[model samples]
Target chain A: MKEHVHHLKDEEVNILLNDLLEQYGYDFTDYSFASVKRRLQRVYINDRFPSFAEFRYRVIRDSTYLTYLMEQITVNVTEMFRDPAFFQALRKQVLPVLATYPFIRIWHAGCSTGEEVYSMAILLQEMNLLHKSVIYATDINESVLEKARKGIFPLAYMQQYSQNYLQSGGQHDFSRYYAANYEYAKFSESLSEKIIFAAHNLVTDRSFNEFQLIICRNVLIYFNKDLQDKVLHLFSESLEQLGFLALGAKETLRFTTVAPLFKPLAQKEKIWRKIAT
Target chain B: MTVSLPRTLVIGGSAGSLDVLLQLLPSLDPACRLAIIIVLHRKSDNETLLSDLLATRSVLPVKEAEEKDLLRPGMVYVAPADYHLLIEPDGTLTLDYSEKVHYSRPSIDVTFSAAAEVFKERLACLLLSGANTDGADGLQMVQAMGGVTAVQDPGEAEVAFMPRHAMTVMQVDRVLKQKEMAEWVMSL
Candidate 1:
């Protein structure tokens, strides 16, 4: 048994990060150091490692241990129609523009657990565009992507999610989308079929396809400015002309250097359309 | 040049905290070099409104904390709604959308503990009037990290449960009325 250390020193954290990159080929150096360090500290304390040195030693030796650490570092907090107003704006404003295209391609970048992606699908279904749309739901973690593909969310959240759906201008009963089975509500297969779930790391992966709409909400906030700029650039290049991009309510295009490239469709919702090539 | 301040001042409150904040902001010295970070338990939509309100009252610039935003002295940063604002080791702000802790997204404890770790002895955290106990553990963290800790006197606070709860949990450095709190901030 080993005693727990309260926190890791900066150098210890750096060494562990470098070790992770060299051993696993996963680069997290560009992620926000504060968040990366905090998550690493939790991994150390929770696993009851005596010291960061030992923690790093175990992570470097066992691939399984490293995988567990990766899960901890990726923040997966999401909800169905998390901010209903954003979705309402999307339903009223963005979806209509998206309808003008014969085919719609939406990339849910970092689609943790797929709630938002499902929400998008539901909105599209209500708008009579689900059959014509293809949603690419990609996350860096396979475990979460698997969860997203299953489309099972806890029953406890259904009541709240239903409320969110109604507020977001849901055209039908939200309960119509899922079946209750004990503690989990399994969403309909028809909704899940329109989505393609894959493992893609925004940090290392390149754009796989062009999209009319790209949603990377609550994901960029975890990255440092350099990484945010890089990922935003990736999103920009991946979007076609006049494409729509939606970010988390707290996120802003105003802070980034690429601000001039996009024009706002809904400012409060962080919805923008690419105006520059 | 801004004189190097020894510590950053962090203020956290909820519910009735806004009135006290409204009073405190106007009195703060515009040239003060200590960075001020405010976290009020607020509705997610009111974040920009709060920043705008505070900016008009204070002489210093006020802005919502952005991802990886650099911290500068003589400016005020408010935690953006729906995200946990953290002080990174490199003295920048990082936002996290992780599930809310203590039933609050910008949980006072989360921000305080992170700031305590980063600034250590060069930190001062003040727990203000609020209806909940969000700031209690955070003030303890600040104190444990050899930083200064204070609470608004329960008598003067519009809603005192927050500061009163903090008073019982730890040996705080000061329990001052809102006016004295403002004076202390001015002196700092």
Candidate 2:
């Protein structure tokens, strides 16, 4: 299954990226080429394209196929409370500021399938801030956004997520947040009320609103340095003064154009606070 | 077959593998110009301080990888837990939080395959003591990419299942003795 499709040459990858941009206004040319090439090869095998030419032909000719292409080209791996320490830091360090605000606005950029959005909602509810908070969850892929809207996830994963919740200082019965429906757990509608899931492309779209807390985790590593700088600048612009920005465990704002504008709130956890002009 | 000497050495392990590394790391010659990467299955908690532990014994510097860091020679790198480490074509390191392969993030398969793709024949891989079969297919990919492959001899492995299982799926170039690993590494 690994090598059913021969390795994608550099020129072929450029061609595919160019085709996607020309036809759909989806610009992936700035994505990390090595990661993109690896994903492209996997897409070829999973979609059962007999050859690279066939894959390219279908992408150029069939708009419907582009949907699958879009979904496959981007990595969508996420989990609830993925790094508990980061969430714990949010509970201890960031939420107090949110509590001070009469109304809190949070953004989950590149929220894949909404796991972290739901996680954030749960966190706010624990702090008695859910009723006052509005969470805007956005992703580049519409399919994942659709899933995020449903508020259902695999029941088996709840155990792991529950552990994460406990580790993050959650006191309530973690099971209280969701009801198990056969193989899936459906989160309560109250949690979903605060969240608005939409498809927003970081590569192409401008900042839609100012956020007091913006969380984009493990999403920027796919991009090139230039694109990362552009997106980090966008995040800087989208933030309110002293807004909290939480990234993945290994991600950071250091060495980016926005570095001077933000200071680490929880340095080890990669949470940064926007500094004013 | 006398192929080009490999410049990158990626070692993968889980379960009882750390003991082997403690034994093997001290024996590595700093003069051997291979960029050594160690991938271990571990909890997200930093309680183990695995890199720090390895650094105490290694003749070379050992540190956890940060995103976009270049792979420099004569150094040791440990993959940060809960993320897959991928080597890009330009020899820069990148991290991915993709789905776990073999019920483990930082899966040996992810790093070995990505390094194989980039380093090709300039890569050499060693699979060590682990309870699961995570490193077998990765070893296979390394061999497929013309990289040298070695697995600890099941007899010498702390948990033989990993090496035994690896040997079943892939044709490795060497069945490494526990004490001779550093020597075998130097020979490359």
Candidate with top lDDT is: 2
Q: Give candidate 1's whole-model lDDT.
A: 0.86
TM-score of 2: 0.94
Residue-by-residue lDDT tens digits, candidate 1, A1-277: 0121366877888898899889888888988787888788777887888766688789999888776788888998889998889999999999998998999999999998999999999999889999999999999988888889999999999999999999888868899999999999999998988999999999999999999999999888888788888899999999999999999876788878889999998887889999997
Candidate 2 segments whose C-alpha is farther than 4 A from its true place = A1-5, B1-6, B46-48
Across B1-188, the per-residue lDDT of candidate 2 in tens digits comes to 23343389999999889999998988888897899999999886644398989999999899898889888888899998887888877888888877788999889988898888888899999999989989888888888888999999889888899989989876789999988898998887
Model 1 bad stretches (over 4 Å): A1-5, B1-6
| Two-chain DockQ for each candidate model | 0.55, 0.45
What class would a CAPRI assessor give candidate 1's docking?
Answer: medium
Fill in the DockQ of model 2: 0.45
Question: Residue-wise lDDT of candidate 2 within A67-162, one digit each (tens)?
Answer: 877888888988898778889999999998899999999999999899999999999998999999999999999988988999999999999999
